[model samples]
Target chain A: AQSVTQLDSQVPVFEEAPVELRCNYSSSVSVYLFWYVQYPNQGLQLLLKYLSGSTLVKGINGFEAEFNKSQTSFHLRKPSVHISDTAEYFCAVTNDYKLSFGAGTTVTVRA
Target chain B: DVKVTQSSRYLVKRTGEKVFLECVQDMDHENMFWYRQDPGLGLRLIYFSYDVKMKEKGDIPEGYSVSREKKERFSLILESASTNQTSMYLCASLSQGTNYGYTFGSGTRLTVV
Candidate 1:
């Protein structure tokens, strides 16, 4: 079975500041990684994904994640964040068709 | 736009009552999933369907059952609703040979009292 571990439960950042959410996964075989964001009272939307080929994957809203095979980590980062970036972010990993998600990290951007 | 739709945004049911959470997707996807969201637990899969009339148990399937009579519709049924079953229920769909990236519905907040 595959599992994901998000290091931070919550992160607070100032506007225009950089932010990074750490994520690690446990899988013996090849795995796929993804990040999703959930706004208040809304469903989750895809942030980015690491399927194959590139280690650095760029997603919507100027967010990106790096898939480090050696570290078994796929961390999400943004050069600068805005107030609208306040939401809950989840890290997920999958070896099979099913995905296993971390507990999630709540990012709060203060102006 | 192509999206997944859950029947209700919020639902309140009594204990031991039968409850149904309906989900529909318009993308002609072959995979549909049911999950429950809690405060600390990000999301726990309840059930999933790969094709019409085909179902599979996810991480947590206890006290939950699912029906997929049609390709677009997947229903999650609670035979006997319990207080512990109160949570945000989400529906998602995807194509085969894919993982992680899914189109999720708005979700249904169910309260069992």
Candidate 2:
């Protein structure tokens, strides 16, 4: 079984400031990690995923996440954030076929 | 590009009504999932179908059922619509051996009154 933990429920940042959303997961063996973003009233869109080969994976909208095996963490980071980047981000892990999601972190960007 | 489409963007149903939510994926993916998104709870999987007529229960599956009669379509049924069942429902599909994750539909916001 796999479980994901997103520490912060809400994160507020000003426009153009860098932001990082923390995510942690626990599993017995290898797993696939993913970060998904959901805009207001929209479905989830895959931000990035870490399957194999690469520890640092980049996705759309200039967002990136690094997988740390020692720390059991996959934290999402963006160099600079915009108001349009505000959305709910979820961290999920799947050991087999089923994916388990964290509570979620709501990112609110301000000008 | 893979596309998952949900039947409705918004829906309203009265209590005790039998409600159906439809999802279709053009990718011909073998896996289809039904999830409900709430305020505090991010996304809870209700049910998933690996293939036509083959289904599996997810984390939370009470008060809900799923049908996959065809390869490209999956349906979620609310046996009895209650206020607690009101939520944002999402449908997603995954290819058999794809590296990328599931492709999600736009989602249906169902409000049970």
Candidate 3:
């Protein structure tokens, strides 16, 4: 079975400041990792995913995440955040047909 | 781009009413899922269908059921709506072999009175 744990429940940052959200997972087999963002009253949109090949993957909205296999972590980072970047983010892990998701981290960006 | 469409953005119902939430995917994806979102609880999977007439229970299947009569459509049924069942319901679809992950609908916020 695969499960995900988001280390932080909420993060507050000033506009144009850097932010990082921590995520970790545990699985006995190889897994696929994903990061998704949900704006207020909106559905989740894929921020990025790590299937294979590279340890570092970039996604839309200038967001990036690194998949550390040894540490079982997939942390999302953005150098400069905007007010629009304030949203809830989720980390999920899947080995086969189903995915297990973390509780989610809510990012609130203030100007 | 793949699009997943939920039937309604918001709904209100009285207790003991049977409610059906519809979802359709234009990409003809082979898998569809239903999940409920709550404050601090994130998203919990209710059910999923891999193919037409093929359904599987997810982590939280109580008080809910799912139907996949066709390839592009999946419906979530709340047999008897209760106050506790009020939540934001989200639908998503995924291609069988792709690694792009699931495309989600805007979600339906259902409030039961």
Candidate 4:
């Protein structure tokens, strides 16, 4: 069984401030991690993915995540966020053929 | 680019009524998945299909059933709709496999009264 844990349920950041959404996973086999973002009243869009590459992967919207295998973590970060960046972010891990998603974290970017 | 399309944007059904949620993918994706999203619960997979007539139960499949008769369409069924089943249903498609990126639909908001 593979499971992903998103450490934060809600993250509040001022506009232009940096933010990080923490995620961790537990898996026995090779890991595939993904980040998806959902704006209000919208479906999820892939932010980034880590298959098998350099630990650091950059994604859309100026977001990036570092996959630390030893730590079993993939944390998404942005140097600065805009008010439009407020949305729900999801972390997902693969279990063989299926993808298991975390509970999710709501990012609230306020000006 | 892949486009996963859910048939309905909003649906209101009475309890005990049968509910059908339709999803279609345009990219000839081999993998299609149905997930329900709720507050605090990001997205819980209900069922998925890798190929036509082939379906697999996901993490949560107790109250849901699915039909994938054709390669491009996947349907989620609530045998008997209930208030607890009210949530946003999302349809997603992966071109290659789980390792590939997923394209998601806008979602269907189902409300069972």
Quality class of the docking in candidate 3, CAPRI style: medium
Candidate 4 TM-score on chain B: 0.95
**Residue-by-residue lDDT tens digits, candidate 3, A7-79:** 9999999999999999999987889899999998778989999999999999999999999999999999999
Stretches of candidate 4 off by over 4 Å are B97-99
Kindly list the per-residue Cα lDDT of model 2 for residues A35-96, writing each as its tens digit.
99989877798999998888999989999999999999999999999999999999999887
True contacts kept of each: 0.56, 0.56, 0.59, 0.76
Measured against the native two-chain assembly using Cα atoms, what DockQ does each of the candidate structures obtain, in the order listed? 0.66, 0.74, 0.74, 0.83
Q: Which stretches of candidate 2 lie over 4 Å from their true place?
A: none
lDDT for each of the candidates?
0.93, 0.92, 0.92, 0.91
- A1-111 in candidate 1: lDDT tens per residue? 788999999999999999999999998899988999999999999999998999999999999999999999999999999999999999988777777889999999999
Q: DockQ for model 4?
A: 0.83
| Tens digits of lDDT, candidate 3, B6-91 | 99999999999999999999988888999999888888889999999999999999999999989999999999999999999999
Pairs that collide in candidate 2 are none
Ranking by DockQ: 4, 3, 2, 1
TM-scores, each model vs. reference: 0.96, 0.97, 0.97, 0.97
Candidate 4 displacement at residue B93 in angstroms:
0.8
Model 3 spans > 4 angstroms off? none
